[model samples]
Target chain A: MKKHRLLTALAVVALIGLLGVFNLTFDSYKLRILNLCGIYIILGLSMNLINGFTGLFSLGHAGFMAVGAYVSALLTMSPELKDTVFYAVPIHPFVKAMSAPFPIALLLGGIAAGIVGGVIAAPILRLKDDYLAIATLGFSEIIRVVATNLQSITNGPLGLKGIDRVVNTGWSWGLAILTVYFIKKLMDGSYGKAILAIREDEIAAEAMGVNLFRHKMYSFIIGAFFAGIGGGLLAHMLGTIDPLMFRFILTFNILLIVVLGGIGSITGTVISACVVTSMMEVLRFLEGKMDFGFFQIQGIPGMRMVVFSALLMIVILWYPRGLMGTKEFNWDYILQRKYLNIFNKKKKKKTVSEEN
Target chain B: MTILNVDNITMQFGGIKAVSDLKMEINEREIVGLIGPNGAGKTTAFNMITGVYKPTLGNVYFNDKNITGIKPHEITKLGIARTFQNIRLFKELSVLDNVLIANHLRLKSGIVASIVKTPNYKKEERHIYEKSLQLLEDVGLLDLINERADNLPYGKQRRLEIARALATEPKLLLLDEPAAGMNPQESLELMEFIREIRDKYEIAILMIEHHMQVIMGVCEKIYVLDYGITIAEGSPENIQNNPKVIEAYLGVD
Candidate 1:
């Protein structure tokens, strides 16, 4: 427990290091991208809990993120924007009367998204494999469609524009750290084992006394909650909102993060999220500038994704166990310095102790 | 009072009757064996008892309470644990985690207690891990505590499965062909292990084993099933000489 707290503290200090140690504008940009990556790490880890660990397929992450985004937006949006955004007086006449600070609004948004995820998961999580994947895809579309059609709230696709810019690099990084820390703690807990067992084998998990429905639902909703938080962070980062932002491709990007990181590995996911997010952001510099001699071709929109998907396919096909293969970054792996030292240490210790 | 009474339990899968009017009584701490040939409805009967399937024509009573069609996990929590014919350990998890998962059935922590990980929850979690480790020790698997379950050998995997089920702290344990794929030596060792577990733990065992030696040597009482029906019920000596049991086994051959 002391180790957990200490790690959390160090993570927070590292998060602050991005802003404190470097004062250059480049540092701000790096921090911004890193902050977004931090959110993605949280999002990716939650999805791993559901799809990777519980062996359930869900594509409704965007839906939960949308819920969090909208809930937080509604709570935090300046009164002037809300007046122009909503066609009807807010459903809660009294709630419409008041607005909160950005942090409170974001927290409320996370809680609301959690509730939404829980309710939806109760029914949608009942499905598995292709059925589950399809159901959750339908759920994401449902959320998207609702956000588009419901002009009374969510600004009906035009989205809440000129929104608050309180979600800077510092807040995003803090949340990312908190999210990963809590997830790691949970994974080490007993409930985490139940979820992992289900993924390894559901029928066996059930017979072993795991409440199959409950664990499946738990993973589904928790993953969704963090994805929702990530959405809130994204909204804050862009300082703008649009319905198109919550599209399937955005969901695909997070999935790519998990795939690159390795399924069921926390540390791997964090590193992958950081690497992928930065690479994508940096690759944006190449957009529409390449001029090939054969056809005068330029970098097209979504080109980076093509490369990313290609990389994802190769990684999955060539190394199905992933970069980390289901192993966590525990003290053993760290002390061993990636297993080399551990192997030698074990051999030396065994032989030396025997001789002694 | 009968702890578990199967009153003419019959199960049907479309046109086939998997188990038909199979009546049995399992009192506390009685090591009973259900022996039969392949597809002899022994697994079907065991499944019905463990609530894997709803019986076609009868009801099962536990502690004088009807538990004819409750969910499998609920039945486990009701003090009945089981092992499968095919070894079904959680392949990705460590052996300790395999046993710790079974402890989930007993954890009374609510969602809030878990997410925040309150003091009470930490205490409960630690206690459960200690208990899980103890169960591993009981099965002589403590040394391979951190090994992935799928990496264990055939015999050890079977033993680990038993240890996982035992972690549920069951009153009645249903073993589905506990000696199915073992060699003669492994099977004999298993027979002794089964007796030792039953006697040492004082837990009732209802095993569905095809090995005659296991039933004859260890089980105090025997039940035989063929074509989804209980054809014979007696002591090992009676089952050995019973013309009906021998004819059933020979006829199938």
Candidate 2:
């Protein structure tokens, strides 16, 4: 255990060092994609906590993200910028007066989302499976609609623009690391076991003295908190935001990452977040004009989505349990090759059983 | 010295009465049996006592406190733990984790304290881990602590469920149909196990079982129900001889 802790500490330091190198060496576009990777990791893990760990099929992430993005952007923007953005309708006095540093704005954004999550969870969490999913999806749409109609507060769908570009590689990756560490610690303790128990069997968990409502609320609120942080980072990264950006499609992208990664596996989410974010950039060619020897094809606006859909379909068909299933990347398996031994033993047992 | 008192409780599901006018009292460290044929509302009565179903009439008292219609987790915290008739173990979790989850209700550390890994929370976690290991050892499941709950054989799964309930540190343990699918040999062993736990933990036990031999062997007192009504309640020997009890199990000629 001591060795494992030491190795983990070293790994974290190495990751920070690598991030520093990328920040110094990478160009603007590459740095932007890297920052997106970190933000996606946070979003994916947060969703996993709700849908995967606590076994609540919530689809309200987009709503929480919108809350975070708008709150943080409104707080960090200069008064003159806000005036220009809210030209259609005057900005709310309270909202106009709010101005904080980037980090504080991000924190307030997370807290706001967390509060919203708690309020929504109280009535809807009694629902199970697809019903819960639908309820949360409806809530997300409701949030979007509210944001669109609440003219003074949200600029009436005009969306905020010219926001400060405060989230760089360091800010995004630092928060992502904090999220991963927090979730890991929460799961390693008794609270995590309670949450997993709810996922495995709710009635049994309740009988075992695990309060279902309270634990579900915990996972939901915490998930929303990190999702808010991710949204704040994205808002500052792009220096512009609109209500359209946080539609159902935004939730679907994060859900896609979580599902592709193995819903219950943190290590899987981290790897797939990086993979899917980078792949989105790499596949940009599919959206642009292409010329091959004798033929040229015009750019297709949404062709990349078709390819992603095909990829998701193939993955679902071939690996029904997703990339890592429910297993995490264990240091013991890497250091001691324990997985290989298990595989070999399984094979040997098969042979022995055949002889019998 | 009554540990549990069920005062004329009735469970009415719309028109049908699942359990009606049932009165039961269990003394401290007593081993009691609730026996009836299928659909006789044995499980329903257990549910009412455990707060899964609110009694349509009357009240349930534990340690002289009225505890009717409370939530299941709160009931467990109030020192009454129960295992389901279908053996509802947390199937995906390991045996040790199954027991550890039961200890969660008694854990003093709040979520923030646990996340921050305060020294107090760490100490509580370590203490619970050791206690769970000890409970598993006592139940003879120490060797299978890391094994998934569902991977265990039918008999061991039932035992694990009981072990999980015990981890709640309950003063009254209610077990529903513990010997449901066990063979005669397994049922005999379960009787010994039930008796052992009662004496070891110094807690009152109320169990529902179809196996007469196991019930008669372990229970000093027994309550027989038929069609949501108590037909007979007395000592095991007396219940075995009662014509009404025999009529409930075997139709009268």
Candidate 3:
């Protein structure tokens, strides 16, 4: 166990060091993609905490992301920038002059989202499964509609521009690694087990002395918080914000990552986030015209989504549990051969038997 | 001392009365049996007492505290724990994890402490792990602690359910159809196991069962119900010989 812990620590440090080196070597475009990968990791892992760990089929992530994005963008933009951006109606007097460092602004954004998440959970948590999903989806739409109409605060449907480009590999990926570390710690504890128990069976969990509503609320709020941070990072990364940017399609994209990675596995979420984000960028080539020597063909604009949709269908049909199921990628799994032989291969048998 | 008092609990689902005016009392370390035909509301009574359903009338008391209308989790924390009739284990969790989850209510650490994993939190977790191991040992499932609850055999699953219930440190334990799918041999073992749990924990146990041999072998007192009403309540022998109980089970000619 001691050796395993040491190895895990070394692996984390090594990963961070490698990312640090990449920060210096990569150009802006490559760096931006890497940062987006980290942001998606945060979003995917947060979504997994609620949908995968607590078994709450929530779809309010886009709304929470909007809250984070708006809060952080509003906080970090200078009063002069805000006035210029909101020239038609003028920015809110209270927030126009407010600005903070990127980290603190991001944190405030997460807190704002968490507050919204908590408030929404009170009413919608009574609904279960698909009903909960629909209610949250409706809530996300409401947020977007509100953001579109609120000209003074959000600059209406025109959106806000001239925001600072403050996101970087260090901050974004640093937060991502921190997110994975802290959430993994939380899940390894008693409170984590309580939520997992709820996912397994709510009634049985309650009967076992787990408070259903409280635990669900905890996961929801925490998930919303990190998702907000991810949104804040994206806003700063892109140097602009808009209501259209946080539509249900955004939630759907992150949901794809969570599901494709295996819902409950953090390691799966991390790996799948990187793969899906990179794949999205790579698929951008399909959006423009294509040349085939003699004949030229016009590329379908939304063909990337078509291909992604097909992939999603195939994944769901072929491997509903996704790449990892509920199994986490940890040192125990990596050193399985050594551990397996010592346990007379019970671990191997267990892994094989429970995969389905 | 009486551990539980169900005083005239009446549960009405719209026009239908599932359990009407049911009253029962269980003292400390006692084993009581509730047997009934299908839809007779034995489980309904259990639900009311465990705070799964709010009684339409009357009160449920745990250790003289009026616990009626409280949430199920609060009732559990107030020292009443229960198992489902259909064996509701945390299927994907390891057997040890299932028991550890039950120990959640007993932790001294709050949400932040648990999330942050403070030194005190680690100590509490170690304590829970040790206690859970002992719990598995008592239930004869120590060897299978690392195995998933869903992977356990039918009998072991039932036992794990009981062990999980016991992890909550309940003053009153409610077992619903514990021997429902068991063979005679397993049923006999369950009877002994139930007795051992009652004696060892010094807890009042109220179980719903259809197995006559298991109920008769284990219960000191038996309550018989039919069509949401109690037919008889007496010592096991008295209940066995009661004509109303016999009619309720075998039907009147």
User: DockQ for each of the predicted structures, in order?
Assistant: 0.75, 0.80, 0.81
Candidate 1 vs candidate 2, TM-score winner: 2
TM-score of chain B of 2: 0.98
> Judged by lDDT against the true structure, how good is candidate 3?
0.91
Q: Each model's C-alpha lDDT?
A: 0.82, 0.92, 0.91
- Structural similarity to truth (TM-score) of each candidate: 0.93, 0.96, 0.96
Q: Using DockQ as the measure, which candidate wins? A: 3
For the second chain, the TM-scores of the candidates in order are 0.96, 0.98, 0.98
Q: Which 10 successive residues of model 2 chain A have the least lDDT summed?
A: A332-341
Collision pairs in model 1: A65-A228, B10-B56
Q: List pairs with backbone clashes in candidate 2.
A: none
RMSD of each: 3.7, 4.0, 4.6
lDDT of 1 by residue, A1-356 (tens): 57766865785677577555543555667767766776787788878777777778778888888888888777777676677666543434544566778887787777777888888888876677899888888888888899888776666767777667777666776787788878877777888888888888887788878888988777777887787787777777777777787888877888887778888888778888888998998878556667666666565898877778788888899878667777776654454585787788899999999999
Interface root-mean-square deviation (Å) of every model? 1.1, 0.8, 0.8
Residues B174-212 of candidate 1: C-alpha lDDT, one tens digit per residue:
998888789999999998888888877778899988788
